[model samples]
Target: MSLPEVRLQIAAVTLAEELSFTRAAERLNITQPGLSKQIAELESRIGFAVFVRDQKRVELTEAGHVFVRGCKDALALLEKAVRTGRATQEEIQPLVTIGHSPYVDPVLVSALLGVHLPLYANLRLRVESMFAQDLVHSVLSAEVDMAIIEEPADSPLLTLVPLVTEPLYVLLSTDHSAAHLASVSFEDFGKVGWMMFPKRANPTLYEKVMEAGKRAGAVPVEVHHYVTPHEVIQLISENFGVAIMFKGIAQQLERNDLVARPLTAAGLQVNIRLVLRADQSSRLVNEFGRAFLKRVIPQGQQAEISGQLLLKL
Candidate 1:
């Protein structure tokens, strides 16, 4: 058996967060001395002091920070395992939540909803909408079993199943100088203006665009942030600025003098992915993921390749 059992790990993690024996013990509904003993046992078993304490204050050791992070992840995984196992044992229709960013294409979302698996006929899906930034946290915390998002931050703990890879498109007024061109570069945006969603909506993609603009010397004359495609349409109609977005979004908003043109900025591609926890162990959830990939593969040959590549990875 492991020396630092779940109880010891919990104690260490709590104490590490609180940095106070009294508070940690109270939170755990244990005596301060009991908490101390558990931490001592953990340190002795692991042969490392996770905390430094004198009379007034407590602090994590250099190694303690790393250990505590691992403890948190381990505890989260254990909790998920218990919940998933209990659901499988008790529920006739085990619910799997699938969250998505509001910006995800409607076609892909429809594809996901259309998937059915003969082996897991009782599996049910609950869909939720969130911004891409929050979707990442929701997936990592197991709030949702998986997420369909665009341009999430890189994490080793996540397995990103790429669903679609396409060039970003820009929505500009028909009267704009670059409107006649089949493709516009970020440099064109520098001369005009740039309108996009706020960074909070999708920090990774927002930063990527900003970085690309910097690399291309395409500094925008003015910057505007918008929340919805309708707002993008309004801004473009007024000749406020050009909005850069995924191809689907641009195409959807192509009307009323708004035109969609591919952005020729290198490395500025839009990547839509189905994100799953790398450590997911539930058979039902894994099967649902496979079913989803299988369902979307029929959309195109590129989609089939994406599905096969996801399986290979």
Candidate 2:
């Protein structure tokens, strides 16, 4: 049986990063048994053990290290060939499917789309919206070409580019008793009903909010769960609860009766990023990523933004 080139490279890269079959399979959104079988097939084709496994842990063998390194370079070159082929096909216009979380500001996304669409007139583009949990999964499974996500993924096999970081704010009904406060601290959060994204949808952000609240002297709070910013805003307007929102969304959600109190606490921010599998990198993906970041920084301020080193990681 012939080994598929892409699958072998991916299996090697993912297993190398995780050093555990189960963990790598989870990241790749595949079953552990399935991943193990693929690795076994790859090993058979190469006539070597890629990983030495025990009851508790998995480690790379000497041959595994060499295979992983060679595959990385080989995969990169293969990606280059595909990108070059796509760019040269005059009759073929590649459609780039970009996935985004429900929390991403629609207005900002629309604006960025306007900037990107004109530049890539030859290439088609599609945007998909999903919950954070699903968005990350879609990226790993290649269900979408790329995604704009708030979750900070440290997976070594993925390429994550930080696009923007906006201050978090408290959204409340103007009539709410605490609405009059000039600025809100995490301590003040326990006073109001707290609206949160489902823990699975955005675990990192949820945990961060909870931890900040705990440090700020807040106790057991009335919490509500919602899927979209619209739902959270509607709940706030109805006085059901207040929510932590990134300042970027303020423009998309227009409301005079609802107010946003900036979180004055230092280090309180929402990070937005462009994420994709590192092995799937392409010229178009890089172009779109940089275009989105440039749009965020503004036209004449490109030099200023560059000097400040805004886009990181």
Candidate 3:
């Protein structure tokens, strides 16, 4: 087979991992039409149809499934040979690149790197910040070694591990009347000015927030949209608008003048997950994951335990 044919096999395996062409295109860093053309060329050479494409979604045929398994094994062997060659020339450190969503706990990243830094001082730990969808795509494509995303992506090529779940909170200026209240309901703040991230950066959260507002009979007055959490909090502190954010974000903010209260009416929680390629069997990845779980999970559980202790006291 030609070099392009081999590359096409890798792309097909990735596409099989994610059933959607749109997502597969994003993972491959190619346009949708380009990906389709490559797939067509590969099929023509192989003389068999690989995907059953309908209007809504695409499904792999039985032959496609078998071919994907073989391709993955071949890719792994080729990668190993390359790594072996590099190791003979120099002591090449194994790198684990991780991607994170804006909502992910920075502490988790810090802790993960901290544990592995001493053990493998030569190893490199790189972190990039992006939206959940992009982070998931990066992990599936092996662009980054792994990712910490807000929610799991619907892909068979990646394995998702639940990290921690945190309650959602509404952040407002301390001077606001609602700031003094222990809790606020959506009904009470229906007409209030609000700040939110743009739909592109946070599609899942944006949709859920809009849906929640509708369910609570609130018509959100968008004072600003597509603002970062740092900017949102700054605006709130200056009394520009109110923002709904995950509780972890509140903990990270150094501004003591801002108040974050539980939104009793919203009743939404955000889940943080660690995503890595299903085929990856790297020791460093597993070590990093374990380190994060060891540090963050206990802290999260302790908060719950402390709350229960206060009730008994």
Candidate 4:
């Protein structure tokens, strides 16, 4: 990472303030060698030496005096800025992270943001989208405070909330013969090329889809891996391969060349659940979840939820 200009200025000011290299190093909590290196780097950047040092004593040069004064002024201004920023930043909502695997629900996210953004004084919400395994790892490591994901089996550390249940749909090209059917089964598409994401993306969902195909007593000769929903859609649209995805996502789509049919063979339900680490505590995430539920879930259904923190959106 690049060193900040403020860092160099702070180092210069710290050295100038203390005068003694040992005292300055102590104040900076860095070794004397580290301090010397820092000063050398700063000097290199400025294209001039700032200090003169012998074995016994250290002194600032004429140019060093001028630079030190400017640095001191800049540091004072920076200190004032830090104080002001802290005051303002305190009003900003605590950073609450919410994680998702692939595309969960854009509509719900938008509505939640719109309805409750102004409700809290310090409730800044950050959304992170990643592969299911990575999301689970994030939650496990406390990198993400909460997550809406399909797989709950990987991390036993999480307190889960069963959110929404939707049927899996088989995406088919409009030109495909099975597209004419209202719904299709894995058995029907057994011989067809299968477009699937890696198991790491979502183990539970991937296993369910694959198991469904196996239960149908047939497997595709070719399996194509895709990275995203749009890629899957693009492949299916071009008659490349077919894929299984949550039906709710398909409802929000307006594709004329691709059709999503309910995959009735596996009876697999896409469980998009909200999960947080059981060992961790996050009032921010809980409050955010409450705000989200208030906008989405009805009052009658709200009381049915056992706990505020674990309740799914």
For model 1, the superposed segments whose C-alpha errors exceed 4 Å read: 1-59, 62-82, 119-123, 298-313
* Model 4 spans > 4 angstroms off: 1-93, 115-119, 154-156, 307-313
Off by over 4 Å in 2: 1-17, 20-91, 116-120, 279-281, 298-313
Estimate, for each residue in 1-313, the C-alpha lDDT of model 1 and write its tens digit: 2557777787788788789998776555445776788888999999999999988999999999999999999988877786667466525767778998766787888987887868766767789998885676577656788899887655556787777888888989988888889999887764767888777787657878999999988888788987775678877777778998778778888876778999987788888888877777666677778777776755555444544333331
Which pairs clash inside model 1? none
lDDT of each: 0.77, 0.71, 0.69, 0.69
Of candidate 2, the 10-residue stretch with the lowest lDDT total is 304-313
Models 1 onward score TM values of 0.71, 0.67, 0.69, 0.64
Residue pairs with clashing backbones, model 2 = none
On TM-score, the stronger of 1 and 4 is: 1
* Residue-wise C-alpha lDDT for candidate 3, range 173-200, written one tens digit per residue: 7777777788876775646777776666
Q: Residues 1-313, candidate 4, lDDT per residue (tens digit)?
A: 3333765676677788677888776544344776798898899888887888889878899999998998877766765664455346535635667778666767665754564545456566677888765676577545677777764553334676666777777778777778889888776784678877676676557777777778778688788887766778766666666886666566555378878788786458777777777655344456666676677667777777655445444
Which sections of candidate 3 miss by over 4 Å?
A: 1-91, 254-256, 265-267, 299-313
| Order of candidate numbers by TM-score, starting with the best | 1, 3, 2, 4
Residues 32-76 of candidate 2: C-alpha lDDT, one tens digit per residue: 776888888888887788899878998999988998998888777
